[model samples]
Target: MSRLLALALASTLGPALSFAALSFAAPLHAQGAAAAALPKPEYLTVEQLRAKYRDPASRFMTIKGVEVHYKDEGPRGAPVLLMVHGSVSTLRTWDATTARLKTRYRIIRFDIPGYGLSGRISDEVAANVQPLDITEGLVDALGVKKLTFVGVSSGGTMGMYLAAHRPELVERLILSNTPSDPVKYDHLVMPQSFIDATARTKANNGFQDMDFWNNYLSYFAGDPKRISAKTRAEYYDFNRRVPEKYPIALVARIGDGKQATIEMAKVKAPTLLLWGNADPLLPEAAANAITRYLGSATISRVLMNDVGHYPPLEVGDRIAQLIAAYVEAGTPKL
Candidate 1:
């Protein structure tokens, strides 16, 4: 199959693959092979997950009838920081960063419906719903007027839409390893090798295949060694528990890149482009494109060495420091 076609297929499969679960019962060295060899894992009910993982900060509310899972942390009166995690990840991705910033800022994060502890969404429900609708509900529900908005990967795409349509609600914007236009930059955004691997996994082990996942996730880090076995297992468990239908439903609603540049041009808030220089999915070229696509008058760019796609998880302290400094510095003059 052609590269673009593979990417298109990959995009649709991306969320589903990440949401599927695995059973990692053996040691890392043994589990990688064992997971692939084992049959797909059984789905863990939301109740089970909540009982096992929910904390004091964990809260649930109805957003468009969906029981959205979210966490509100830090001082209530402090500056607000709304974080959005990318596909295949949940609010927990910000756990490390939130820990560092909670003392100073009000950090709000949620699972994007299908992932994490968020309620499952069917394809029918997702077709009529846009990510912005859910996001707006969260903001309005929390009575947040204006705040700093942060997102990674696909989550960053949601941030762009919100900043464009709800300018007053976003005091500042920060994006990391986000794609400005996925289709337009398909060559850079989804490499051929990655596409091939994705296809092979689908054909062989199916979406629940953790063998591919073990190696696939490693590619997100500059140093594969940075992602320990324990972390991979955590991701596997999270993916396995999500209802099978949610990821497919979520991907069906993802917009093509056809209108990304137009939407991005509408964002006028002060912006920070935090990119990982080593990210294979979104490389330096992708970063440059976002700068060109954004219409923000006050923009700052930071490229960290040795970091990869998931900055919050890989280098949370640094992300926290950057966010604190930038938000405290106030809006930059044009």
Candidate 2:
């Protein structure tokens, strides 16, 4: 059956059946505002994704009291490539590149807490948890002695944190469409206008505005056409399945981006920064500020002509090639 039809049917039956069937179906639909903004997937869950994608060596690891999902490919002892996804995005964001890199390095990707299949935080905790904690905990769980770190957007932010705080764990760093200093980004700063609008929207109980979300995605893609229908459908379905409050919580956590930027100079790993020059969310100037603070780090900037915030999806092959070359040439001598 078509994915949309299946999703509609599952939704009618309620959350239990929807979760069960969707988790097993290849490219299950992801429901949410973000999903409406991105490309649709053939499947959503790890099982469904595996059935459609075909990773010969894939497994799951429990870390930080959560079931961390990952795909391990290539030789067991080959150089490892760790991919961290952006906010509100799952590992599926790297599907295209991961498929290609499986031949060279052992590539791994996972969902952070409050995202994808990973568990959510306790309701009692008012303070937001940092994604870096999940990244570090997952690294330890995977038994990875050393590896390269590739992060996109917020994922890239986490990559910066990892390289800064745990330089010993990272061999190389690749950041795409991520602002090094969050404070400067308007979205992170959450001006009065945005805060007022968000509060009003919540008060009105208008949580799922498809048009607004789609427009946001368009800005991220640099063009709406770039986001495939399949990707959008799956993303939306995933959103619908998860709690509605999560995105609000995420927005608040990102507001602390300025604090993250302060630690940029401490990131010692060789870094490559990729930006979609046209990205509305994180402009080139924001990325420039990050490059400025990366001391003693070899930095190469690639301006994707037509892409936006989600470079991995918009230009997956090009990104994979850049990462492969950077890691191969710039990996520090042991």
Candidate 3:
């Protein structure tokens, strides 16, 4: 009788212990799954971006269907200098140079759609509104009958597009650090490996890939240190606030690079090509390619020593002087 009773008790206790073990392990398993599901830092909002940089001012306007943000300064009657910022960058990128040119030209700088303070396009509106359309809309909204366009990187592409599509509006064109024919320029092509790496980094970090900004700044400025801590903080803040739709829109436009290049041949404005000898992204060869396509357009190349892609910011005074001289020389016949 004692053996049988002991056996029964042992069997019941064993099952109970097994159940308890499983119950205890359930929470740990769930915790692990939760951790795996956590979003990366790259997805974090611009508000969460560090405060090591800052910009001077902000302004907004209704262009087409979106609320466009811009910085307008200097005398209204003065020659217009429309400064276009690059990809993933806001109007603030032009802060250093615009300030120096403000006394001479009416500087107009704006945040392109999906960048800076500008909001995303509504789904109700057609999904086909590209950067070129938005730029044209902005010009129309500003009532700029004629002006000089100074574009950098993506902005340079937009400027070229504008000159091609709307010849009557542009007086002088400045293309800096932007490819004229992005599709034909194999060297300027962004590698799939780079894009994949960036996507992975953003997914894992919950924020944009730091390398993108780092590479951009390094390629732009001869001295990365020239980009002030305050300015960086501001840029990070603005970047963080950027809407998710911004990246989506930008990717869509990039995919349309072929169409953009076709439009480049139609541009008839007198163009000045500015490039930094040390620029890694868009090399001097790319600048020469751009100049080749501009028929009847006067191309003035200014290769700043030690300066990277962003000569305007690294050497604002010099950039302003060159621009002033070009604009004063008279408008190019379209």
Candidate 4:
């Protein structure tokens, strides 16, 4: 990220902003009030999102009464690969890496209910349903008996939950820049910038906040040049579509002052954690905190120098090679 930005934020919003969950109990009153005043995001419908974000191979299926936008490709007989996108992104984020792997493996990736092509959960039972529940239920609805999971950011956060709670479905895992409780352990804090971005959203009645944009680009790669114009536009569109409550609710799921129940020992599938040294969110040191819990499962840690939060995006070719090698040997590389 920007050292100047970090320094400015620390100086202006000093004494550490209190971390808040998505609940009223967590002191999220101000943000909630702001969200209440704000209208629901526009320009993203299931059909429109699919048209813009989905590939030709993409399809939509109803799972637990929710119309889930998904893509299933590659040889039917090949090994299955399930990909989960992050909070603000759609399955399209995996297009680059998925294209590379499709030649060798069956690829399946989908948009979460509140994101990308899925839009929002239109199901009658949408109330109180967790992302984990929707995701697992979707897998069952699709009859995906077994697969390896490739998750990033918030997706990795949910992936760990699924692996711990329902190990039978996941055969292996590639978790990149995953955090258990983001509110609790914010790798870096840029409070002023976040506030400024929100204010810019108010001023523009849209999501054209470059302060946050720069921060976001920084989150992806240390060198902002890697983030192309098209990538920037797509991210803006997807993120602008985000409802304020969605992120709050995501972080609030475990309740105020509580951490997600991630049983590392329960994650028996061989695990691969790809971290970027320049990751602005959870620095490499912070990312390693999750390793102690892998227990008996073979664990591989690939530390990419000079990369940022999203390894699969920053270094997809190298990441794909690592994943291919990992799948073949199916063993830890220490």
What number of clashing residue pairs does each candidate have, in the order they appear?
A: 1, 24, 21, 0
- In the range 53-118, model 2's lDDT, one tens digit per residue, is 434544566654545566666777889889877745778889888877888888888766555655
**The best candidate in terms of lDDT:** 1
lDDT of 2: 0.60
Decide which is better by TM-score, 3 or 4.
4
What ranking of all candidate models by lDDT puts the best one first? 1, 4, 2, 3
Candidate 4 collision pairs: none
Candidate 1 per-residue lDDT, tens place, 1-334, comes to: 4454344445433563322232212123333543454555455777777787788888998877678999988898999999998857788878888999999899999988877888888666676776687889998989999888998877777787888899989888998988775433234444445454454444433444555556567767877776767667767777667456546454212355567777888998888988988986677887888888886637798898789888887888889889888888845964
Per-candidate TM equals: 0.83, 0.72, 0.73, 0.78
Off by over 4 Å in 3: 1-57, 125-128, 183-206, 209-216, 246-257, 330-334
lDDT of 4 at 25: 15
Candidate 4 clash figure, as a count: 0
Off by over 4 Å in 1: 1-13, 16-40, 183-200, 203-205, 246-254
Cα-based lDDT at residue 299, candidate 1: 78
Error of 4 at 210 (Å): 6.1
Compared with the true structure, what per-residue lDDT tens digits does model 3 show for residues 99-121? 78898888898776655666656
| Model 1 C-alpha lDDT versus the unseen true structure | 0.72
RMSD of each: 5.7, 10.7, 16.6, 6.4
Output the worst ten-in-a-row residue range by lDDT, candidate 4: 15-24
TM-score of 4: 0.78
For residue 187, give model 4's deviation from the true position in Å.
6.3
